[model samples]
Target: MRMPLLCIVSAVLCLSAASGFAQGESPPAPAPSAAEAQSAKQPVFNQEQLDQMLAPIALYPDALLAQVLMAATYPGEVAEAVTWSKANPKAQGDDAVKQVAKQPWDPSVQALVAFPQVLVVLGQDPVWVQRLGDAFLAQPDDVMGAVQRLRQQAKAAGNLQSNQYQNVTVQAAPASTASSAPASTIIIQPADPQVVYVPTYNPTTSYGTWAYPASPPVYYPPSPLYYAGTALMAGLAFGTGVAIVNSLWGDCDWGRNDIDIDVNRYNNINVNNRIGNNQNTWQHNAVHRDGVPYRDNRSRQQYGRQLDGASQRAAFRGDDAQRAQARDRARASMDKAGIERPATSNRQARDQVREAQANRPRATDRQPQARSNRDNPQARQTLQNRPNNSAGRARDNAFEGVRSPARTTALADRGRTSQTLAQRPNASRAAGHAISRPSAPMRRGGGGGRR
Candidate 1:
């Protein structure tokens, strides 16, 4: 009994030692939390990136620039506007905006048709447009600040100044309680209130020595067609003047980091998007976003909820219901007229059709009658007795009084010189005329003569 007890104790001790050894290795790290994973995926643009993105359009007229920033938020609409602009290249200025008033694009996007050149530049680089829009949506203040910085740099470099196309005004930033306002505000406006000219410039050179070497400014020049007959100098080139009456209605409110609407101009151009007298500040309209996803979690949380499945379906439900009603009415009319029609949704009707088809005799399934049928002697004799002059009869009927010439006639001879004098009465005269007529000059080259 003592020996057995000692052996059991030894086995227990060995098992305990093995278990402790197994527990000694380090455990795997805990999985990242959902928030951490999302943060890792989201992109946060820095000041340099914002500057790079806004460089191309930073110097645009205040009202046009404001509309562009507002439009950028709806990248999908921007793309549609690009396509529309390309399709209707001749459409521009206030007239163009009025023409697209019925379009489903955002008011800002519709207004952009006034300057096809701007849309051309925006469409050239889709990725840039998307990123610019994302940056604007995520950090409005940062984007506005970046624009100011670029404008300041251009002004300091003497590249940006008052010209025939636009008037540049620089004033000390108003003493405001809000810290978002800049030290100085630069406002650019069209020289003529009615005619707005889009400026074309190389962002890199116009802004002087670019500070961010890692993220250089993107410079997309407008097509020469936009600036035809207009002199293009070194610094900034103004394209053909776009005569706009009220297409441009939004103005950059630098102090508030938002856009302010000219209610009168807005109403005039956007008959459909007119706002109340009190509603002067421009707000982002998610309905015009058209289901485009936001880049970051913040924007997604803010505007993404505005468009739900129910609302999206509601957009088409009215038209669908109307169509369904029309179809029902048409079917009723046909039924009253004693016309038979298949029920679109009835499986039984389809099955009946298939059954009828299956019951009908098929040509392939019918056995052909044997060539030596004993009972068809009379029918065979009738077929044999039928005359084989059917073609001749048809020809005689077609040409009642006209007789066909004999096959052995001189007219049927292949040889040009094988006819007697009577048959070839005019043949010698025709030959003399052919000999006298000039033959076409022979083509020299082996290749098929000029097409």
Candidate 2:
């Protein structure tokens, strides 16, 4: 009995040890959080959309353009911020940044005070501004790369006519060189160091050389890494020979408009100042510059921190996208209180004038003329009694669109010696014509008209 008991005890201990080893070797799988799943399903920016959005700013110097894009992300704050900037025009660069640092605005907007005009243009459309912000947040690196590429492509196509911004005007180098994009270097001393001019060309028609294989022409940059079959030129040449996907394609208003902003409340604005308000459009995965999930300090998370689970994610108010939204609420409050707007700019005046003009008809419409000459009996009589001679009939029907052919057929029969006016060959007896003698031009002394 002792021998049997010892054997069972030893076997039990061995089985227990094996179970512990198995558990140690293979850990349990982790279930995915809702945030991870949501981030995974987010839409990424396709190359074409990115390229189009970045086209206008592509010409801008890197640092300023960065501020412009970031400001564009917070479009709602733009008007108020622009108004404030105008109020304090002397405060710029570091000084402007300091003034708005404590304000409850997005860091992007705070940084944008130095550039009021960029903010103004971007503020015109809240939706586009939000889209650009989402795209930038989702893929900053990709967006930057696309910007560089379009500039290079424009250069290669000789679209970059001149470049004072880069000071890279020289003899054309191979495609590898940055200066190769411009045709020639014609340097001029800029009058204002504050201003820079960058000449551009039409991307559609000017984008040189393509492969036309019985279908639409396909354009590609002179790069071997880019595969031949890729949809490289698909955006620029859809149906037409060349597509104008440059600034002309509603890409960006790439001009500087330094005007005073009239501080006023615009009541007609949605509370959620995002492109579509839902936020997850081109939001994509949140991979930071360092390729990790990191939060921005000047973000909207402060308000949203009061929530839990999916609600917290939905309450993501830490980014410029959220902080900028506060401007909308502020604007609505001002309007409801019935505050009068400040002095308007030249642009606002022109816009108001245009609106007034669009609502009313043109000044040239004062004289009430008949829409159709066919309504006048004299006009019909003139067409019907037209002489059969080519010159006389041609002069009479010059202004007519659909003239009666019955008159022509009747006139044609009058010239025929064998056939009467009713016997002329005609399509439905209306359009047929017979040759007729020309009416003699009246001499100076003649009182009667001659047939």
Write candidate 2's Cα lDDT for 103-139 as tens digits.
6555446656654444444544556556676566555
Over the full model, what C-alpha lDDT does candidate 1 score relative to the true structure?
A: 0.83
Candidate 2 segments exceeding 4 Å error? 1-23, 27-42, 83-104, 168-451
Highest TM-score scorer: 1
Give me candidate 2's TM-score against the actual structure: 0.33
lDDT by residue for model 1 over 305-412, one digit each (tens)?
Answer: 643576667546655767878888999999999986665667978887888899987875553544444348987887788889989988875664345455334444
Q: How displaced is residue 403 in candidate 1, in Å?
A: 89
Candidate 2: Cα lDDT at 159? 54
Model 2, residue 213: C-alpha shift (Å): 17
